[model samples]
Target: MSSEAFRAGDRPVRISVQIAPQHLPIAELRDAAVHAEDLGVDMVMNWDHFYPLSGDPDGLHFEAWTQLAQWAEATERVELGPLVNCNSYRNPNLQADMARTVDHISGGRFVFGTGSGWAQRDYDEYGYPFGTVGSRLDALAHDLPIVRDRWTRLNPAPVRRIPILIGGAGEQKTLRIVAEHADIWHSFVAPDELGRKLDVLQRHAETVGRDVADIEIGNELRGADDAKAAALFDAGVRLFTIGVSGPEIDWAPVERWVRWRDAKNG
Candidate 1:
């Protein structure tokens, strides 16, 4: 695992909220993001999907990058981005440029969370080829360098070396990509499952010549509490994201996690 395996716990815990982009008015979504920032979340996020993942397939939806542009301007302190952008949807260079623009728009608070992409519906309905999983991952690997190089060439430059957050638990390709390019690696594994995955991630990191400790670990707070947070913390997760949907925004769980974060950090 090298020296990087246990380093994530040294950083302060961060709380993020993923406001799902479906079945709600744009105004409501905007307001929810604003409110979350007001409540002191360390980050705010939205999903990158053309259609709703649940409820109605044809429900109201907003585009990811455009909404993020708006969000960049809306919140003042919280970091922001798509929870996990589908790499196949946009050109790599274009993706890099958009990320740079958003970084500027957010005054350097954007976190580039992306994945190889799943969801056959997004591809079939949008005219993208729903190729095999291996193909999509291959696309992600090919594009990431272009994205990074584009960032280097952009005018004015990004305010900071924008953090790249890669989401997925594919022990083979995804973790390898994370080891190569990501500053943050997000996963949706159970606490019990995390140790094994982190072991896999560290082994992949070693193969890529990266110190696994250099990457921050991100996880979802789906019904998570103090105990779950403690267990994940022990397993090396530091950035915790909570998923919330709209019509009405809930604060209880968010506050609970925030308190847990502070306690953990303290």
Candidate 2:
């Protein structure tokens, strides 16, 4: 898709902060959510996992959607969601209900970010099926539309049409699902890989008769690299995210990205 096709007038480059919830106290996590909003972050995200991805797996952890409920009550400005909630964790209808409730709690400031299950540890420890990638992606493809449909049928519908963000770079099933269901597509690939993934997504969009430009591109930042961000911006990514772990949350990188966003806006 051409960049011009996706361009909105003066849309500021958005920076997001993903808080590693496993390592922090709930109170501290709440405080961090408030602080992130205070710091002018475009969005705040938490990972969906039963154990810590970094540090000790047994150290500390929190559930994704529950934390999001607290965040919705705690913050006023920043949009919030799980970076990617595993599709196998809950019933699709239940997930939609939870997201809709949170959307109402935040007064329509929520993004429904989801993904096909990964992380063998989470599945194994939590007793969720540790299926093959293909199987998980298949489950995701089936569940996404169910979630969307459930949102419409629920007694109190979502405060807004919650934007769906599908996170992954799988060339076949995952990207195809993103093209079909996602309003935002989040991936962790490098710039070159992102270019290829965009091609895959475009191909999928063509098959579905949808415009690839309708989906927003989101990428995780490896570090503070303006040149790299520029490269990604050129590749059609507008949302850039950085992950920070607690109890020593580093706001430096986030601050730098905010500055970079401001400069880009100027």
Over 1-266, each residue of candidate 2 has an lDDT whose tens digit, in order, gives: 44555562334689899998978889999998898888888999998988888888788788989999999999998999999999999999999999999999999999999998789988987889888999999999999989999998998899999999999998979999999999999988787777678878889999998887888889988574878898888877889998988868888888888888888888
Q: Which residue pairs overlap in candidate 1's backbone?
A: 4-213
For residues 98-199, write the lDDT of model 1, one tens digit per residue. Answer: 999999999999999999999888999899998999999999999999999999999979999999999998988998999899999899988889888888
Of candidate 2, the 10-residue stretch with the lowest lDDT total is: 1-10
Q: Considering summed lDDT, which 10 consecutive residues are worst modelled in model 1?
A: 1-10
Candidate 2 ranges with C-alpha deviation above 4 Å:
8-10
lDDT per model vs. reference: 0.88, 0.88
- Residue 144 lDDT in model 1? 93
Q: TM-score of each candidate?
A: 0.96, 0.96
TM-score of 2: 0.96
Candidate 1 regions with alpha-carbon error over 4 angstroms = 1-4
